[model samples]
Target: MITGIEHIAVLAKDSKALTDWYVKLFGFEIVYDNGKGTYFVKAADGSMLEIIACSGDCRPTEPKEWGIRHFALSVTEDGFDEMVEKLKVEKVEVVTDVAVSPKGIKTFFFRDIEGNIFHLIFRPTPL
Candidate 1:
């Protein structure tokens, strides 16, 4: 049977830069690096992301690309505001201000170093 997501993947023109960015900002540790421009970084909670460099002369994805638009990470309700402020202090580019969903979830959008979007969310109840 199907389970939850194992990992999310993104293409990078510079694997080392992207990997280091995740490690420095999100505290994700490098699980594996192929030494040929492919890396797997794992979060403290066990979630993983594959950061790979595409072959020859590839470019970063545009913000308005037609694929998966953004990835999300959740924070505890108590720590939500703190995390938001932390991102601001780190100078992450904010795409959207906090918005409340009908489900009472609050989320804000920001961009990673490579312009990939991320959502920081806080929910009143876990689904």
Candidate 2:
């Protein structure tokens, strides 16, 4: 049987900065800092996102591009609104305004320090 997703790895020009950005924005804690361009960040639900430092130009995916578009981080309804406000105050680039899908999933997208797009979603009710 297939197990759940363990983690998602992303290559970054500056792993430390990317790790710090997740920690600051989403409360992810640094579980491992190899000091050699590798960082393991753990979220509250035990999901991990690995940030690997690399030497190359950072190219983030954009809308209509192939490959992965973006990954979502589920949040509470209240949290969703609060986060949007916080991002605005922080001057973080908001790629899209808050919108609700046909399925009633509310979400908004934003860019990280490295221009990686992340969707903040709130599912008020079960699908």
Candidate 3:
């Protein structure tokens, strides 16, 4: 049986910029970095996001990948606003405006510097 998400890995062209963006926007801290192609990030809930540099002919998904289309982060209301503001300050493109679900959760979508979409979702209470 599937337990849970192990980690979401992104092939980074500039891993340093990606790492810095995550740290500044989402409070992700570096758990490991070897000054090489690999780095690990630790979220507040202990989830991990790994960044690995890819070379030669490699490219990000082109809207036709088989699975794991995108990644989302659940944040508090305050965190959601804070992240949005930070992105705006940094001139990162916001692809989707904030929207509320029928279940009353708020979510907004944005892309990383490399065009990787990530969602910041606000869940007011337990599901």
Candidate 4:
């Protein structure tokens, strides 16, 4: 029934700000924005992360939810430091600073303006 992750939806209080943040931080371009509370962001790989505003009863999920804890993005080993520097320039909050895992991958965690945590990681080089 499931093939791969099509998109992840996030509830946004300020859709424009969220859209702009992704654009500025990771170079995500806006594929579509309805102006009524729904917007779609796409990366170079065609994966998308959507944001929709809630009104009366709609609510965003907490991190402890049973499904979809958070999203992870892979970066190149050489690009790891450059990526962190870019995030710093944008003034985004980095919850977990860069660190190397036992498996030899370099990783870091950061949150969007809306508090959605995302991980950026790079694979280790061959010995």
Best by TM-score: 2
TM-score for each of the candidates: 0.85, 0.91, 0.85, 0.81
Query: Compared to the true structure, candidate 2 yields what TM-score?
Result: 0.91
Task: Kindly list the per-residue Cα lDDT of model 4 for residues 10-78, writing each as its tens digit.
Answer: 877777888888888888889998979789999888899898875565443455777655678778888
lDDT of 2: 0.86
Clashes of each: 0, 0, 0, 0
lDDT of 2 by residue, 1-127 (tens): 8789988888887888889989998899999988798999998999999999867677888967998887788888878889888878877788998999887789889887887888899997865
Q: Which candidate is the best by lDDT?
A: 2
Quick one: how many clashes does candidate 3 have?
0
Query: Which lDDT values do the candidates have, in the order given?
Result: 0.85, 0.86, 0.81, 0.80
After superposition, candidate 4 runs with Cα above 4 Å error: 56-67, 125-127
Model 4 RMSD vs true structure: 3.2
Task: After the best TM-score superposition of candidate 1, give how far the Cα of residue 4 lies from its true spot, in angstroms.
Answer: 1.5
Question: Which is superior by lDDT, 1 or 2?
Answer: 2
Candidate 1 residue runs with Cα over 4 Å from true position: 56-65
Tell me which of candidates 3 and 4 scores higher on TM-score: 3
Q: How many Å off is the CA of 52 in candidate 3?
A: 0.3
Clashes of 1: 0
